[model samples]
Target chain A: MPNILVVEDSPTMRQLIGFAMKRIASSRVIEATDGIDALKKLSSEKIDLILADINMPVMDGLKLVSLVRSNPAYKDIPIIIITTEGAEEDKKRALAIGANAYLPKPIQTQELIKLVNSFISQ
Target chain B: MERETSIGKKADEFLQLFRKGEEFTHEILKENERLRFKLAQLEEAIERSGDEAKIRLYEERIKFTEDELNSLKERFRQVEEENKDFAAKYVEVEDENNNLANLYVASYQLHSTLDFNEVLRIVLEIVINLIGAEKFSVLLIEEKTNELIPVGAEGISISDVPKVRFGEGIIGTAAKEGESYFSENIHNLHNRGSISTETPIVCIPLKIKEHVIGVIAIYSLLLQKEKFSNVDYELFNLLAGHAATAIFSSRLYTQSERKLTTIQSFLDMLKEKPRR
Candidate 1:
């Protein structure tokens, strides 16, 4: 029943994340090309969670997180930042700006599903 | 007077006999009371013995119940342990399944496009997303020059990458020999961004059958990738075959298209000329 929004620039990465998200029982995966496309999808659907990559074209994930946090209607939704940035500063910044969790790639799909499920089941 | 003395003595005798009878009756009553007391003590002892037997029976039942409860508790613990092991195994299997899915997706996308540039882009994406390569390039062997030229690159500029002749260096030799090279010191590198033209961490030669077409050289992996995994080796094998075919076929298709266009233009020019 949870709707997960996946925002990534690479089509292959997007497909990879989407494939993992679909394994969650009764969960619907909404794909977006980048942060801008994520925002567009956000307006149309009631997104339960957001899995976004920090490095993306058009708009990055941090900007998306900031935008989502500022908005009253979408503020409560959980956001998981998936990125290749393994630096502590990047992780701390993402959390400080309102990302619920940070996951670095190369992504373990099992871990990804478990983390999402935890947030959804909460 | 003699007769009166005789009667008084007889009376005295009768009184003495009555007193002796009264003493006998008192002794008998005392003996009966003592016997009753002994009987009461014996009955109480018997009752006490019966209560002890019941207590012993209840104690045995309680001991049995306690043992049964402990057995059940142990069984529950075992079941819980088994469930935990199953959960761990399930996670492992799921991870394996996801790895397979990555392979499937990478292979599917590689062959999905016939555009030469698109094919190169897919290869780069697979290397980045699946293989976790950070600094890498797809170099095709230039037929005329017999050199490997960078067709696609990430993390380093394509112009900066050096071209080497076939069978020259590690990468070139990999292409020439149609073999994959994985550096033993891949995990020992301190600076991941430093470009080493001669020493790439991995070089997978792309081949169509026995003909080596190109090579995918990976200089550095992502910061989080400590080493290559089994699935990564499988991906390399897959890329060696499928990516090579895709790239080769797409290049051939593009070349043939250009040749067809040029030939059509020449035919049009010939038709346009007026007969003398």
Candidate 2:
């Protein structure tokens, strides 16, 4: 079972994703309110994967992704940027920053589950 | 930035050096005295009220400068408070969203029992509780009157909303234009004597398609003036859509029930045996 880290500024979004993931995945879900906090958790915890939201205060998810990819300890951990921003440029940037996947907000649960499974399988 | 700091330091050093130089310092003192003598000579005319217009002009200039200084001070205060409030909102939205308020709204929207008034009350609750507005109201659009009539309200006397109309007040203009407005400082603004305090008013237009449906108005006691976020717009629009759908559905339900009764009574009459 993969331990998933969920980073989002919105509680509703966190719950929506957490609930959906709980229903679908055999993983221990952890939460972080913002990118800085997310960074701390990624370092201290053994996180297998991540689901992060963009447009957060204190440090944004894009910066967080770059940070995570740069860190030697957490570099290989698959981070999927799950955000409301659905622009292609944002998607490309996320991937370019070493994000494993990108899912837009109000994420369809089934699709999210499929993506998670594919990531875990790989 | 460093150059600006260096310039300030150099100016302080220059003043110190000027004070150290006795000869140059005496010369500067004489120059100041000469300027003061000239200023006093010119000041005699206005001081004696030789020309009332000139005196009035000086008074007005003094008042204008004072007012400008006060305004700048207020602007500084507003900006500082605004930044603090922004930080607070960031904290709040993070914390409140943790409570699943969005899901609550979503589920609430799905419930058919909430009439327009009830829905508005709920919306008002969101505004007051979550958004931190001191006063909030949802005024429904009356097509007949072309006015936004108050449906649900908070932090206002009923006497305040005495038959408000379009083109009548600030709210009216906002509602009429179907545009959101945020007056950070409302001292110079008019509101038909409805709003008493010289506070900021944030008016959000509620519309569905081309028809303006309502207005969500809130008054800010804080320096925060951001009236509506994307989430707010989305939720307000969703709530409006919910209101419209629920209204149509309920009306249809009532019509069906009436028809069902009529059909039942007609069948009852048809079942009766005919007399020869």
Candidate 3:
């Protein structure tokens, strides 16, 4: 059972992502309003994977990815960036900064689940 | 003496005859031996031919089995490919199911509240999350002025949004005509940095039993949403019906509450009057 941390600022978007994550068998979803809340959750819970939105209010997804990569204790955790549809620069930067993969919005739930499952099973 | 010579010649002739008969019998025995050797060689050749026939039969059987095995392998490959195709199709159906579920939830949440502000918030949420609209406004028709005014919005301030008179522009026309309008060239109308109300991609009229109350104007979609999807259309239909009812109900409830408060205050003032 992998614990997935979803970091997004919009309440409805966060809820939608959380709803999609629930379909994954034996997976637990942890919600955070922004990157700062995500770090807080990371310090407390044994997070197996992270799904974060690129644009957020406090400390965006890229900053969180860089921070997680630089840290020794949580450096190995997989991060999947949830990018806007045509934001190629954000996708490239997220991957370059040690993000495992990306899922664009209007996200396909099956695709998101498959990507997570792959990372979790790794 | 002639009789003795003739008898001696006769004896010599008989001796020659006996020697010739012995030579004839030796020739016959040599011919019999040659025939026996030829018979043995023919029997050996027949045995070798029988063995070659059996070997040829076994080779044919092996070849047939090999063909069957290859055929089975080909069938297995096809079945595997078919299984892959089915798996992909199943995922597609599942994705579609999830999208429908989102629409259900959006509809459910809209009607779950009686607060006007809460209803507006739900509308905004549905547009952002389900419709993927980045900039939009909920404009209700003002009763006295006959103009559509922005009551709630996202990605644009309420003050920034201009009021549209009845049947004036795209939004006004949509509201006045009580019909939804979707832009044909939405792909080319994407603005990168700033938000604009000049060109709206979609305008859905909120109606209650053919009475148009307001309009949901979508100026631009999120950067990722290059085109509208089937599910988005479903969501718009849902919003047109459910959102309108929710907003109308909540506004009525608030108005009723205010009226009750006013009536209660009037009674209190009468009671506090100097025993008149």
Candidate 4:
């Protein structure tokens, strides 16, 4: 099973995303309410993909991406960012910081799954 | 009359016989009571056996019906499972197709807009996705200086675009050759001391009228060092040509607008002339 780590601050969104992923990809899903929690989970378990929100307390998604890329061990793992930042500069920054894929929110469920699939396909 | 006389005589004989039959009537009554008691006993036996028979028959029917219901429920579950699997696969395939459509839409954005900046941006992005290149750039030739100007760039980091040259830089060499060139080492290709960093890259010329008008360079990350293939060369060449044509149209529009404004001003100046 490909392990997916979902890092979001909202509980409702967490459950909804988890439910959607579960029905399609029968893999273990680990949820973290904040980036700090996500980082801890990343340390303990092997994660194949990450679906992260941009704005989160404790540690934001951008910072998490930088941290992940900076680590040699985690750099190869594909991270798909889910965010409200639609600006080109933001996209540039995200890609520069080692985000493999990006999706803007109020994300269509189909679009989100496609982006997810692209990363996990490798 | 004779027949009626015979019937009346028989009736008188029967009445006389009935009057003498009282002793026989008492004996018949005793036998009828004994037979009535035996009939009631037989009816009780049937009532007890009939209930057992009816219950056994119903229980057998119920067992058969319950077996059928269970089979139906099992079939329904199997159908439901198959339906769920198909629906999930449909959703997955549908999402993939929509992205394919979206990609086409994004690609079509290049052919629609004549805006130079947006066109360059769209084409480079499409090519980037198409070729799976780590980075890409589009440099339009400045008409006056003949210097390649980086109008649109993505997937690479080499700024100082507005004041860049064409003859001596990697782009300049491609322009001088008037042919698409690929160099794995950009630092080896560029000796101008202009670009300080050493990175592996590919440089291609965007040609028009058999004259090199612009240059394109794609760079991979420091890790990936695969050189550009013939396919990348051709794809980028086509994209760059379309982009250059769009640029020419936009530049033409701007020039004509300037001329129109100048003519209008000249006509206004004539209106201010005094009649002799």
Give the number of the best model, judged by TM-score: 1
Kindly report, for each predicted structure in the order presented, the TM-score of its chain A compared with the true chain A: 0.98, 0.93, 0.95, 0.93
Q: Is the docking of candidate 1 incorrect, acceptable, medium or high quality?
A: medium
For candidate 1 chain A, the 10 contiguous residues with the lowest summed lDDT are: A104-113
Q: List model 1 lDDT by residue over A15-114, tens digit each.
A: 8888888889999999998889999999999999999999998999999999999999999999999988877899999999999999988888878999
Residue-level lDDT tens digits of model 2 in A18-107: 766775557878899999999888778889888888778899999999998888988988888876555688889889889989976545
Docking level for model 2: incorrect
Deviation of model 3 at A116, angstroms: 1.7
- Candidate 1 runs further than 4 Å off: B1-20, B143-145, B208-211, B259-276
- lDDT of the candidates, in the order given: 0.91, 0.68, 0.87, 0.68
| Lowest-sum lDDT 10-residue window in model 1 chain B | B186-195
Q: A35-105 in candidate 3: lDDT tens per residue?
A: 89999999999999999987888799999999999999999999998866447886787899999998777
Task: For each candidate, give the TM-score of chain B.
Answer: 0.85, 0.44, 0.80, 0.47
Return whichever of 1 and 2 wins on DockQ.
1
Compute the DockQ of candidate 4.
Answer: 0.04
Interface root-mean-square deviation (Å) of every model: 1.1, 11.8, 2.4, 12.7
Candidate 2, residues B1-276, lDDT tens digits: the string is: 999999999999998887779778798899999999989988995677767878799999999999999999999999999999999997677545533445454535435353444444455544543344555666767779877777666777544544458755767877788776777554533343355422327676666554567676765421232344455555555544554454345445667888999999999999988978
The residue pairs found clashing in candidate 1 are none
Query: How should the candidates be ordered by TM-score, best one leading?
Result: 1, 3, 4, 2
Which lDDT tens digits does candidate 1 get at residues B1-276?
Answer: 999999999999999898888888888989999999999999999999999999999999999999999999999999999999999999789878988999988989999989999999999989988888888888999999999998889988898788989999999999999999998886663346477967888999998898999999988887778888888999999999999999999999999999999999999999896978
On TM-score, the stronger of 2 and 4 is 4
